[model samples]
Target: MDIYDEIEIEDFTFDPELKIFQHPCPCGDRFAITLDDLVDGEDIAVCPSCSLMVKVIFEPEDLEEFLED
Candidate 1:
Protein backbone atom coordinates (compact mmCIF):
# COMPACT_ATOMS: atom_id res chain seq x y z
CA MET A 1 0.00 0.00 0.00
CA ASP A 2 1.20 3.50 -0.79
CA ILE A 3 1.54 5.76 2.23
CA TYR A 4 0.94 9.48 2.42
CA ASP A 5 4.26 10.13 4.08
CA GLU A 6 7.34 8.65 5.64
CA ILE A 7 7.97 9.74 9.23
CA GLU A 8 10.66 8.80 11.64
CA ILE A 9 9.54 7.25 14.91
CA GLU A 10 11.35 9.99 16.80
CA ASP A 11 9.13 12.55 15.13
CA PHE A 12 6.04 10.97 16.63
CA THR A 13 4.74 11.57 20.10
CA PHE A 14 4.61 8.50 22.25
CA ASP A 15 1.73 8.21 24.66
CA PRO A 16 2.76 6.12 27.61
CA GLU A 17 -0.77 5.60 28.84
CA LEU A 18 -2.07 4.39 25.52
CA LYS A 19 1.24 2.97 24.38
CA ILE A 20 0.83 4.41 20.94
CA PHE A 21 2.84 6.64 18.66
CA GLN A 22 1.03 9.62 17.18
CA HIS A 23 1.72 12.23 14.56
CA PRO A 24 -0.37 14.99 13.05
CA CYS A 25 -2.39 14.14 10.00
CA PRO A 26 -3.38 16.67 7.37
CA CYS A 27 -7.00 15.61 7.81
CA GLY A 28 -7.11 17.18 11.28
CA ASP A 29 -6.71 13.94 13.14
CA ARG A 30 -3.67 12.03 14.32
CA PHE A 31 -1.95 9.14 12.64
CA ALA A 32 -1.49 6.40 15.17
CA ILE A 33 0.26 3.07 15.60
CA THR A 34 0.76 0.86 18.59
CA LEU A 35 3.99 -0.45 20.04
CA ASP A 36 2.78 -3.98 19.57
CA ASP A 37 2.29 -3.31 15.91
CA LEU A 38 5.81 -1.96 15.52
CA VAL A 39 7.31 -4.79 17.47
CA ASP A 40 5.55 -7.22 15.19
CA GLY A 41 7.22 -5.53 12.17
CA GLU A 42 4.37 -3.24 11.19
CA ASP A 43 5.25 0.30 10.14
CA ILE A 44 2.08 1.97 9.02
CA ALA A 45 0.47 4.61 11.16
CA VAL A 46 -3.05 5.39 10.05
CA CYS A 47 -5.22 8.39 10.74
CA PRO A 48 -8.44 7.63 12.55
CA SER A 49 -10.35 10.31 10.69
CA CYS A 50 -8.94 9.74 7.23
CA SER A 51 -7.51 7.23 4.81
CA LEU A 52 -4.05 8.77 5.05
CA MET A 53 -1.27 6.64 6.40
CA VAL A 54 2.40 7.29 7.13
CA LYS A 55 5.17 4.75 7.20
CA VAL A 56 6.98 4.82 10.53
CA ILE A 57 10.74 4.56 10.24
CA PHE A 58 12.34 2.73 13.11
CA GLU A 59 14.72 0.05 14.13
CA PRO A 60 13.64 -3.16 15.85
CA GLU A 61 16.14 -2.61 18.62
CA ASP A 62 14.87 0.89 19.29
CA LEU A 63 11.54 -0.51 20.43
CA GLU A 64 13.06 -2.41 23.32
CA GLU A 65 12.83 0.51 25.72
CA PHE A 66 9.10 0.76 25.28
CA LEU A 67 8.38 -2.82 26.21
CA GLU A 68 6.30 -3.45 29.31
CA ASP A 69 8.18 -5.25 32.01
Candidate 2:
Protein backbone atom coordinates (compact mmCIF):
# COMPACT_ATOMS: atom_id res chain seq x y z
CA MET A 1 0.00 0.00 0.00
CA ASP A 2 1.07 3.62 -0.49
CA ILE A 3 2.39 5.60 2.46
CA TYR A 4 -0.21 7.61 4.27
CA ASP A 5 2.22 10.41 5.10
CA GLU A 6 5.77 11.62 4.95
CA ILE A 7 7.68 12.33 8.15
CA GLU A 8 11.12 13.81 8.14
CA ILE A 9 13.65 11.48 9.72
CA GLU A 10 14.53 14.36 12.00
CA ASP A 11 10.98 14.35 13.33
CA PHE A 12 11.47 10.89 14.74
CA THR A 13 12.56 10.47 18.31
CA PHE A 14 15.48 8.16 18.68
CA ASP A 15 15.35 5.96 21.74
CA PRO A 16 18.91 5.13 22.61
CA GLU A 17 17.79 2.38 24.93
CA LEU A 18 15.41 0.80 22.47
CA LYS A 19 17.63 1.68 19.52
CA ILE A 20 14.61 2.62 17.53
CA PHE A 21 12.98 5.69 16.09
CA GLN A 22 9.38 6.33 17.10
CA HIS A 23 6.65 8.81 16.42
CA PRO A 24 3.06 8.80 17.57
CA CYS A 25 0.62 7.57 15.02
CA PRO A 26 -2.90 8.90 14.58
CA CYS A 27 -4.18 5.43 15.32
CA GLY A 28 -3.01 5.60 18.93
CA ASP A 29 -0.10 3.31 18.22
CA ARG A 30 3.48 4.32 17.52
CA PHE A 31 5.04 4.34 14.09
CA ALA A 32 8.45 2.78 14.51
CA ILE A 33 11.54 1.44 12.82
CA THR A 34 14.76 0.11 14.28
CA LEU A 35 18.30 1.20 13.57
CA ASP A 36 18.79 -2.15 11.92
CA ASP A 37 15.95 -1.35 9.61
CA LEU A 38 17.54 2.00 8.76
CA VAL A 39 20.90 0.45 8.14
CA ASP A 40 19.24 -2.02 5.87
CA GLY A 41 17.88 0.93 3.86
CA GLU A 42 14.32 0.85 5.02
CA ASP A 43 12.50 4.17 5.04
CA ILE A 44 8.99 3.13 5.96
CA ALA A 45 7.69 3.20 9.48
CA VAL A 46 4.57 1.19 10.01
CA CYS A 47 2.06 1.46 12.82
CA PRO A 48 1.79 -1.96 14.35
CA SER A 49 -1.90 -1.59 15.14
CA CYS A 50 -2.96 -0.26 11.77
CA SER A 51 -2.40 -0.41 8.04
CA LEU A 52 -0.99 3.11 7.97
CA MET A 53 2.59 3.62 6.95
CA VAL A 54 4.82 6.70 6.84
CA LYS A 55 7.75 7.38 4.61
CA VAL A 56 10.82 8.37 6.60
CA ILE A 57 12.84 11.05 4.84
CA PHE A 58 16.47 10.18 5.34
CA GLU A 59 19.75 10.38 3.54
CA PRO A 60 21.81 7.25 3.03
CA GLU A 61 24.87 9.06 4.32
CA ASP A 62 23.05 9.92 7.51
CA LEU A 63 22.53 6.24 8.20
CA GLU A 64 26.21 5.59 8.85
CA GLU A 65 25.79 5.99 12.57
CA PHE A 66 23.14 3.30 12.62
CA LEU A 67 25.19 0.83 10.64
CA GLU A 68 27.20 -2.00 12.14
CA ASP A 69 30.94 -1.49 12.00
Candidate 3:
Protein backbone atom coordinates (compact mmCIF):
# COMPACT_ATOMS: atom_id res chain seq x y z
CA MET A 1 0.00 0.00 0.00
CA ASP A 2 1.10 3.55 -0.73
CA ILE A 3 2.01 5.83 2.15
CA TYR A 4 -0.67 8.39 1.33
CA ASP A 5 -3.21 5.64 1.05
CA GLU A 6 -2.55 4.46 4.58
CA ILE A 7 -2.28 7.94 6.08
CA GLU A 8 -5.27 9.94 7.28
CA ILE A 9 -4.45 13.55 8.03
CA GLU A 10 -6.57 14.57 11.04
CA ASP A 11 -4.48 17.73 11.56
CA PHE A 12 -1.36 19.49 10.20
CA THR A 13 0.81 22.58 10.66
CA PHE A 14 2.92 24.19 7.98
CA ASP A 15 6.34 25.48 8.97
CA PRO A 16 7.68 27.56 6.11
CA GLU A 17 10.92 28.37 7.83
CA LEU A 18 11.81 24.78 8.54
CA LYS A 19 10.61 23.81 5.11
CA ILE A 20 9.70 20.44 6.65
CA PHE A 21 6.98 18.88 8.72
CA GLN A 22 7.81 17.90 12.28
CA HIS A 23 5.88 14.67 12.64
CA PRO A 24 6.05 10.99 13.29
CA CYS A 25 6.57 8.39 10.63
CA PRO A 26 3.60 6.15 9.82
CA CYS A 27 5.91 3.25 10.67
CA GLY A 28 5.83 4.69 14.22
CA ASP A 29 9.28 6.24 13.87
CA ARG A 30 9.72 9.91 14.72
CA PHE A 31 11.21 12.06 11.96
CA ALA A 32 11.16 15.43 10.19
CA ILE A 33 10.55 16.49 6.58
CA THR A 34 11.11 19.54 4.41
CA LEU A 35 8.44 21.01 2.13
CA ASP A 36 10.71 20.62 -0.87
CA ASP A 37 10.99 16.96 -0.04
CA LEU A 38 7.30 16.27 0.57
CA VAL A 39 4.69 15.79 -2.13
CA ASP A 40 1.40 17.13 -0.88
CA GLY A 41 -1.27 14.55 -0.08
CA GLU A 42 1.42 11.91 0.15
CA ASP A 43 3.09 10.19 3.11
CA ILE A 44 6.77 9.93 2.18
CA ALA A 45 9.89 11.10 4.02
CA VAL A 46 13.67 10.60 3.97
CA CYS A 47 15.18 9.75 7.31
CA PRO A 48 17.81 12.27 8.36
CA SER A 49 19.95 9.95 10.42
CA CYS A 50 19.56 6.65 8.60
CA SER A 51 18.61 8.12 5.21
CA LEU A 52 16.02 5.40 5.01
CA MET A 53 12.98 6.41 3.02
CA VAL A 54 9.74 6.17 5.02
CA LYS A 55 6.03 6.55 4.42
CA VAL A 56 4.28 8.87 6.84
CA ILE A 57 0.56 9.18 7.52
CA PHE A 58 0.35 11.31 10.65
CA GLU A 59 -0.26 15.05 10.22
CA PRO A 60 2.36 17.50 11.44
CA GLU A 61 -0.31 19.41 13.34
CA ASP A 62 -1.06 16.36 15.42
CA LEU A 63 2.56 16.30 16.52
CA GLU A 64 2.38 19.97 17.45
CA GLU A 65 -0.73 19.37 19.51
CA PHE A 66 0.95 16.50 21.27
CA LEU A 67 3.95 18.67 22.07
CA GLU A 68 1.75 21.43 23.47
CA ASP A 69 0.07 19.07 25.88
Q: Please name the candidate that would achieve the greatest TM-score relative to the true structure.
A: 1
User: How does candidate 1 score on lDDT?
Assistant: 0.93
**1 versus 2: better TM-score goes to:** 1
Task: State residue 5's C-alpha deviation in candidate 1, in Å.
Answer: 0.7
Q: Please report, in order, the local distance difference test score of every candidate based on alpha carbons.
A: 0.93, 0.88, 0.50
- Each prediction's TM-score versus the true structure: 0.93, 0.85, 0.36
Clashing pairs in 1: none
Clash count, one per candidate:
0, 0, 5
Q: Model 3, residue 48: what's the lDDT? A: 56
lDDT of 3 by residue, 7-54 (tens): 333333456656566555456654555554444545665545544454
Mind giving the per-residue lDDT tens digits that candidate 1 earns over 1-69?
Answer: 879999999999989889999999998999999999999999999998989999999999888888853
Q: State the lDDT at 1 in candidate 3.
A: 29
Assess candidate 1 and give its TM-score to the true structure: 0.93
Better of 1 and 3 by lDDT: 1
lDDT of 1 at 66: 84
Candidate 1: which stretches are off by over 4 Å?
Answer: none
Q: What digit string (tens of lDDT, one per residue) describes model 2 on residues 1-69?
A: 689999998899988778899999999999999988987888899999999999999997876765543
Q: How accurate locally is residue 16 in candidate 1, as Cα lDDT from 0 to 100?
A: 89
Q: List the residue pairs that clash in candidate 3.
A: 12-61, 19-34, 19-35, 20-33, 20-34
